[model samples]
Target: MNPEVNEDKSSLYNKVVEGKAQVYFHKTKNEVFYNPIQEFNRDLSISVMNTYSNVNNNKKLKILEALAASGIRSMRYALEIENIEEILANDFDQKAVDLIEENKKLNKVESLVKSNCDDATLLMNSMSRNWKSKFDCIDLDPYGTPAAFLDSAIRAIRSGGLLLITATDAGVLCGNGADTCFTKYGSVSLRTPACHELALRILLQSINSHAARYSKYIVPVLSLSIDFYFRIFVLVYDGQMKAKESINDIGFFHVCPECHTFYQQNYGKTVPTRGNVKFVFDSTSPYDLNKCQNCEGTLKLVGPVWTGKLHDKIFIQHLLKYLNTKTTDDFKTRERMIGMCNLAYEELDNPLYYILDDICSVMHCETPNHNVMRSAIMNCNYQVSYSHCAKNSIKTNAPSEVLWDILKRWVELKPVKEKWMGPEYRLARILKTQPKIQVDFSIRSDCTPESKKNNLLRYQEPPPFWGPGSKPKRKAEDEENSKQQNEKNQKVIEELK
Candidate 1:
């Protein structure tokens, strides 16, 4: 029976048995066998499994799959992850529990897997006295928002525990339905080209802030965007410093459409900008959108978001090594997982300008001018723009057109402001007048030779990618180039003297 058919087959849904998936209906004596849709919950469960399996030294880890639904996720954890010692699958539905029980027995893994019929929220809330600090990994895959279970989930995970949350309600997070997200998560979602990423960041920030309210801190290890679901894995640490650090890294901000301006104040730096124009009425209030002056586009207000980069290269490399040694088709989903991982990895550092000059170096892709490269990178979801001043381009996390507008403002101003104030300070003042740029988050892409030298100094990569040949060639080029650059610097210094 096809579960999608929705013919009272909820209890009789079939599952994979052994390597080949077999569907056995308990309600009827008939056994139907066929391949399942790749888009089913099972596929998601596999992705979740593959991610956690990347966790190192999990031998003593206690894993919980709250709202275990079909218990497929729990079973995957129990059977696949050798590091996981204790696996708990909890669901309020007694019938689902029974099915889980049967599934565990069918796989002959009853000893490793435990099935419980109880409210997942209750189970998580009781961790204070019942489990205290027992669990290491808590998976929360709910039917919708997952906000209702957040409080309990936070309490359940131990210090240095891993919390994997999945929110399928993308509409709310993307600001398509802002009122709903505000009511549910106490966060304002923004609508923009980067809305998808903004939604995930807001959800992560909500979790971090919610955890901090209880004196907890969370450092995100990996965040993935898969179809309609948003998955975030965070590590919980105990201590006020940890809590403050986590909260400090995630924040809220607003953008103005009319002026192509934005205002972002970190957790500790909360001073309101003193200017004639103000996009944000409240310093710590929810985010909102306004109208753009230049283009008349509705400015998107984004945030209540995370600031830290997503994928940890160390973690990804470890997982890649593990995959290389494995002889199973289990690595089938590796391509998709790696794609998301690479995106997160690339975004870990402060995103810099992909100028026509730098594009060839970073991506090894050639372009004619800043205009063409800017257009291409923007199409690839990267914010890119051009300038005629010291640094001729800038690229960052904000949306492309928004950044372009800011660049235009700076261009018209022609190196505006006092020489004493830095780029960020001058940019902030410029944003004060142009409220549209005030709401977007951006960083300077002014890459000097010294900075480029520093970046190359600490560049890390796979063996073949960063082998002797790679650096030797670049080192030879840099040595010869460095001499000329030093001479030019000396000429300027002598002229100043």
Candidate 2:
């Protein structure tokens, strides 16, 4: 036979007769369907499994994969992870279920995998009643939004269950379709340069919000951008208040134009800047800045941008505590986990505020209300305020994601900064003179003697009112004007009386 013909025949046999894909991944061998995309996902799934194995305490784990396209991820988890005690794998397609059964037997994991053909939503609803506290981990790797199946997935996951979610619609979360994002995900999108990081934060917050309905606390253990998708590994611990607190950690960006600098603050703390400084209180918005501070030249905002740090050193340390355990089997898996843990620990700090703000803004715009945006702005360690109309021009002279990048010099504002006594004192003096600005001073807090004295010295406070004797009376021309005013008042009083 000709060499070319022979090669073609072999390729045909491997694909058609032998039932194999391009890559022969461990625990993924079977007699049927294959996909390279699924292959990559399986690799990721196995890594997660190996990590779970290190922490399993020999307890029975119930794992459910809602949408098993080729049963690749389910198959790998079932066959490889020793810690996985039981799995209930479901696929809506009957043919897919058949392949799942075959793969189960081929991998000798049939005893562990219980394959079924049913809509994931239906299965999740049915499981809600009987499967309460049943599953130890629930993985949802869907084709797109995962929004249609999200409520059910939230319900199916056992409290304290691991919910591994993957969102492939990067464009939507990254601010391409701001309206759609708000409509579907209940959030807004701000396309900043650090858009990917913003994408992750928005996704995490959306997941947290969705999970909150089921009384779950989602602690993000791992988050990464992979294969045109965003994946997050969150541990769903049981707690109402803790979950509320977790959701409240979202932050916002306040951009400043004067200094070509943006002020980033959170929602939870007091609003740092005043409401009106020459008719504009915020001096910032969620948008990017146009000018450079130092040279006045327009600068660029480059991103994948993460404003907060990626990981907590203490959290990384806690994860590493399980590294030397005997339960973990694969060296490669161990290395990946350790690397992720370290990156999260070492690089994660400052909470990625720039990215967090954009994320929340994107998500906020997507949602029907400003709840998520408000929550994020309300709870951050700093302060944030909302605007009804565009306060500044949206046109940025620099890269759209410029502010998404970390500032060259970050001034950590002191928590105990003094209040703005200048404005308050000026207003107080004005109130004393006019007394009829229709303003109320009862809401104003008393200033310290030193603060009051300082304002007096700084020319911030107007001179105090003095008796008429302290200054010459009005001039003859002014007296004539006063007499005319008195005559007018007498006429109006006489008419009323």
Q: Which ten residues in a row have the lowest lDDT in candidate 1?
A: 464-473
- What C-alpha lDDT values do all the predictions have? 0.56, 0.50
TM-score on alpha carbons, each prediction = 0.62, 0.55
TM-score of 1: 0.62
Per-residue CA lDDT of model 2 for 330-435, tens digit only, reads 3333444444344344332333322333322321212212233223222322222211011111212223223211111011111212332243432222112221
Where does model 1 exceed 4 Å of error?
Answer: 1-13, 17-58, 130-133, 256-263, 269-300, 348-371, 374-497
